[model samples]
Target: MDQFEVMSELYSDRSNWVDVRRYPSTVTCRRMLRLADFAAADPARWGSCRMAFEVPELSYRELAVARGVSHTTIMRHLAKAEVGDAGDFTARELDGECPEWLRAVSIRFEAGCTSRTYRYAVALCTFAAAQPERWRVLRLAYECPELSQEELAEVAGVSQPTVCRYLQPVRLEVDESFNDLEVIY
Candidate 1:
């Protein structure tokens, strides 16, 4: 009845009745698209570099190998891509970094992020990771998607008048240089 045995039993059978959360890959992909759009909005990010070049984890060497370019060209491309602080590197943006606790939760969400350690922190992180449009939608929806306006207000911990506040547009703002990520919204 302890945790280990429960997990072990669950793992032993393909047909175990235990619940497995399903990810809407489309939603994730759409969110990524939206994030890309947001990143692109900064004119500084424009360059010959493709999306692959700005990816957080890819090193200059890896990029060079992938593009069949010299390391210098890779570095140059990364600079042109405006990915931020090419001299330093961090895997996740500060505003999108989930706590170690939530790392496991992201796995449950099937999102390859740290949600188990962060819980709702993960949700906020993902929201921050999204594009402006996606962020607007997610912020409002998380306040309370299923509730009446009054109820939604309570859920969002805001005044009822604020439920409709979601319609007001807000721009997405990532919190730090991509190189030294710390925490998500």
Candidate 2:
């Protein structure tokens, strides 16, 4: 099927609106949560925004009904949330340009941010996206969370230590950022 046809079928049923493939990685999911928290300033919309992503199997109408709002309201919240903007950032990063959104997601920790964990997730994801090898490892790890470091190493055609090495920097960065945030607070 062509892309247009696929999209049409995908959207024809509001009840079946969400497709897991749209979110390809944990990094993307984290970015969506971060964006939702930032853009949906209204607490109600913020909850809707989170539901829209977290419960990917739920349709807009389903989400709206669950939230006791109109489906259009859920749609508006997601539109304002810019959940799809992560793809654009990934595309720009792939094209060798550092996107502004990436910088904002990775660098900024504002009052609107939902949690320290999300900030660290986006920052680590941003760091992974900056390097090709690290990106592959990160993607693989997220896709197969059940896999061990040794298994990931085998999949990536490297040693277990190398897999650990690929992820160590992100771990360290998260730890450092926690300390940084603690000091600032």
Q: Find the candidate with the highest lDDT and give its number.
A: 2
> Cα deviation of 170 in candidate 2 (Å)?
26
TM-score of 1: 0.24
- What total of clashing residue pairs does each candidate reach? 16, 0
Best by TM-score: 2
Candidate 2 per-residue lDDT, tens place, 91-179, comes to 54577784444343212223242244444433443443345465677678877999999999999888898889887644325433333
Report the error of model 2 at residue 38, Å. Answer: 2.5
Model 2 has a clash total of: 0
Error of 1 at 25 (Å): 5.8
User: Ten residues in a row with the worst lDDT in model 1?
Assistant: 2-11
Q: What is the Cα-based TM-score of model 2?
A: 0.30
* Alpha-carbon runs more than 4 Å astray in model 1: 1-27, 30-144, 169-185
State the displacement of the C-alpha of residue 169, model 1, in Å, after optimal TM-score superposition. Answer: 5.5
